[model samples]
Target: MASLGVFISCTSDAKKTNDKAKTVTAAGDTVATPEAEVGTVREPVDTAKYDALVKKMANGDTTGNWAGRKGPYPLAGAILPFKRIVVYYGNLHSKKMGALGEYAPKEMWSRLNQEVKHWEKADPSTPVQPGVHYIASVASGTPGTDGMYINRMGDKQIDSVLKIAKMQNAIVFLDIQVGLSTIQKELPRLEKYLKLPHVHLGIDPEFSMKDGSKPGKKIGTYDAADINYCSDFLAKLVRANNLPPKVFVVHRFTRKMVTNYKNIKLRPEVQVVMHMDGWGEPDLKIGTYRHFIFPEPVQFTGFKLFYKNDLKKAPNRLMTPEDLLKLKPVPMYIQYQ
Candidate 1:
């Protein structure tokens, strides 16, 4: 991770004032005021260039040559008002793999690496563009279980994922499943990746547990204080890096997962997108969003469709872009399982 700091520069000018009441000036000569020293003005970034880049991204055309092409596509202004949402659920750790069963013991770590390679190779047909954001689980083991924390792949994995994201032009949301650990404790360790402009944070409160309780059974709820701490830290981190605002993702299934959400103070600099991760029947999922989330001021809501679960239900409502747009505050991201 690069050192987080703001860059500032100053320029100075000096001017002399004429104290004499009588001034003999040449014809057509204007008297100049004593030069007062003025501070140097920082040059503004080429916003037009940035806008053009954004337009290219929105049009799904990330082809032009750019000078500083490092991480994922800059999503500063690419996100539209009522665009469809796409959410991805997966972990880098082998033990906590996705339900796809594609990754296994010996190959789990290599799987993500290989997946990124595949994604890069298929960028022309299936680019990991900005419309879809990838959520990589940092904490290993089960969602609610406590276990040893490891980056396993270290910086190599982080760089690999970031490069893939850049090539695909997608955002990376670091999913933090806080188990026995507090949000405060886990944040610092994940700060390395969060420093990246393309990276954001996701909180799985379902996995958050009370001081002394069982993991799976304990459904932790974040009070205003907890949410504030997380948001504030992220906001500062983003500002320090001179990057665009970071999006904070909160997953909610049952009401208990997010209690007193109305009271949580959202930081102006940070975007708080509340997602409904309820996976089940389509009607039931819609009902959950309508009853609990629609009335709130959340910017976005998320719908998760299980390949096996939702596919079996009656009517088999798999949420499409059209179904999501009908919601009051349309979901910004849709999670596919």
Candidate 2:
């Protein structure tokens, strides 16, 4: 079952308009230009607390980390609030040849590689390039799954993704199902790919159930311990490679997906983002962000607009150039079909 909590200040509808610019309507209420609503800048986050959190993670300590932090906005840095043009490259199975379970053929691989290259080269003036996050398949080689039985396409898949990242200098997100393995256990295997400067991590908590749990069950819950394990490992790996702090992406559709989520201690050096993957209408997208996302301390947030699914339901409300601009804490990443 899903749970809801009210922790942050609700956004008011009182339009704060500028004398110079035109007003706009967002979330059913007319609002002034974004610049007019800039209230007292939120105080800078306490760096001392952030420093202590990093030390605790490095030492494998999870205690007291959750005690000090509060709900909603725990950290700060709105300089580049997330934008809404992010694209999520999910479903590698669709890129495979023949039957759904068939191995991804060389032809399919080449085609996908070329397509990604094109996206990388997309004009920067267009909000499509450099911001695309390619999600690698986590269920590819797992036994008993539809994608299993094929030769393990481990580094081969990683290599293809890296090529796009290097070509566009874009961020590459490694998606992990963690079906049967713990995050720690899977880290070493992915070290070769993770060491790349552009690579980041995406955890599919839906498939991170403990042993004996059924698939599609409400199984994965990221507690302080789990987050510490992830942060510490990635921090060390990134430092060893002399790369910038790694981005850790967590997916959540309902509240239960990330129990005690607000308490997860993260390193300041590492960028952590919680993405709401509730796919459906554009209005649903707006509501989700206003109700669930505006409260979180995520460094960035993502929105997925289905080229086919979205067009089928509310063809008129499909996200447009102007609609994309109004997303609060502008979406850092936008996903397409």
Candidate 3:
């Protein structure tokens, strides 16, 4: 939470004049100014070649060329060689979770497969991993029996999504919306599922309720410490199970949702992807990505496309694979809600 006081304002204003220019970290917080330089200045990454590569990919040239390849990280385990991960985000029992939940199970899987095939046709060399990202733990507007402001799904529900992913040899992501509960409380409950090699995790900062407010009443946040705790938790699981590194995805659209990104520890056993979870027309979506996800550097990145929200505009269309491939750092993971 941002400090609220005259002192805080004064301090923020003081940073504006420092020789070490204030810059936004991946978490969207201003970096602290140091009294003196501590290390050699780093050169900016050259994206000219990367842009050309994606441009070619966008034009239907799959000839084994792509940027932001997700391999050699070794932490990704059997799902190695990261390519594009297209996920259907929703809950099987609720229509509000997203598009993935609105259709019949078989029909939903069919739609997901069709999208996967589309991407494969676009870029044969880059493998597209299909995923069903289920909201295993839902954030409730009212606090439940545990006063966590959350409602967790039963094992049967989780297994349903897991089974679908397995049928397609795809991966499963169990997303957590903590509400008034802390990660400490909600994450451990899902450890059993996360122990599986093919299963990963997603945390929604929008419903975190860092200030003890009800979910959906106001936006929430997750500090770097919270993120680190999740990483450390998953790293332990991988070590204990002798499994591959797990991907820890944290969804964010606004800057405040994630604070102090520089402090987020990247471990060999865990990969972090800062996912852009926003909804709008193509232009608004692109601007949000450029302003939020593009400037923030993390281990990896993801983009979310909302079927209903996206179609609210005149075009009434969702972004195609070609349209999204143009992003500078091609999203390693893409989600449809």
lDDT of 3 at 271: 72
Sort every candidate by TM-score, greatest first.
Answer: 3, 1, 2
The model with the greater TM-score, 1 or 3, is 3
- 2 against 3, candidate with superior lDDT: 3
- Which residue runs of candidate 3 sit more than 4 Å off their true CA positions? 1-72, 76-81
Q: Which ten residues in a row have the lowest lDDT in candidate 1?
A: 2-11
- Best TM-score among the predictions, by candidate number: 3
Task: Write candidate 3's Cα lDDT for 1-337 as tens digits.
Answer: 1101111122111112225323232334443212111121323323453344444433442433333432233332333233678889887777656756778778888998898899888768778878888888887756567887777887778766765665666678899888788988889988877766667999989888878787777889999999999999998987776556687789988888999987888777787888988888888888887777766666577888887778887866788878887775667778888
- Relative to the true structure, how large is the alpha-carbon lDDT of every model? 0.49, 0.47, 0.70
Q: What is the alpha-carbon RMSD of candidate 3 to the true structure?
A: 15.6
Worst 10 residues of 3 by lDDT: 2-11
lDDT of 1 by residue, 203-313 (tens): 777666655343444555666567778888987875565445577778776777777666776553466767776666778888887666655544445555555566676
Listed in order, each prediction's TM-score against the native is: 0.62, 0.59, 0.77
Cα lDDT of model 2 overall?
0.47
Arranged by lDDT with the best first, the candidates are 3, 1, 2
Note the clash tally of each candidate.
Answer: 10, 13, 2
Q: Pick the candidate with the highest lDDT.
A: 3
